[model samples]
Target: MAGIGHITQDWEPVVIRKKAPNAAAKKDEKAVNAARRSGAEIETLKKSTAGTNKAASSSTSLNTRKLDEETENLSHDRVPTELKKAIMQARMDKKLTQSQLAQMINEKPQVIQEYESGKAIPNQQIITKLERTLGAKLRGKK
Candidate 1:
């Protein structure tokens, strides 16, 4: 029996150093600056955000801190027990694996596993898809 490591092929990595054209870099810089000026998709981190009062908006700082806290403190308990049980029972009734159930709903199997195992909470759209595919209501009832 051979392990995956033993089955590996010979390989070589190459390092090439090339200076990018100045015009393209300048064009990109101008485009990024325009976007930042227009308040488009990018957020710029300045050289001195740490322990500095130079930042204009206190609300931005507060919102960023709140977002960080919310992300770090997510709860598995947010997944409803009723929804979990309903998905499980329906899958069993149909004699379907989690992968099969996910396929029927046009989702990935890992998504089904995540919701069923209470590691994640489904949104309204996902709940609707589950209800339709599983033939069970995930909302608006006991």
Candidate 2:
């Protein structure tokens, strides 16, 4: 009994102390918050893109666009046919074939063909080249 007396145990609740937040820990928390915000922003951007694509897809069809293209073709056909003749004459005067002229101008031969055939019109830059190379004045130029 004297050597091994019963030890009285205090069953008091043990409180665990958490470490105080330091400046580095606060910085880490801020980085985590920034990452979460960035993730949310990315999700929002993806949703917006999906919505826009859906709206665009729903609005138009190929058949309607084709009809519009047909009207455009009709209007193009009405452009005076003399421009085509001028382009062809210019090429002939230069002793240049369509492919040769296209090479000189850095355009495709088909582009020259389109201009000569009056299927597609050339803009002012080409008009200048046509005049210079062909030595002929366009119908409406001064």
**Which candidate achieves the best TM-score against the true structure?**
1
Cα RMSD to the true fold for all candidates: 20.3, 17.0
Per-residue lDDT of model 2, residues 1-142, tens digit only = 6899889988999899998667566458575587587784322224556536776665577767767778433444422577877677767877899999888777788878888777775577876776666678876753
- Cand. 1 TM to true fold: 0.47
Q: What is each predicted model's overall lDDT from 0 to 1?
A: 0.78, 0.71
Candidate 1 clashes between residue pairs 3 or more apart in a chain or in different chains:
none
Give the range of the ten consecutive residues with the poorest summed lDDT in model 1: 71-80
Q: What is the TM-score of each candidate against the true structure?
A: 0.47, 0.43
Give the clash count for model 2.
0
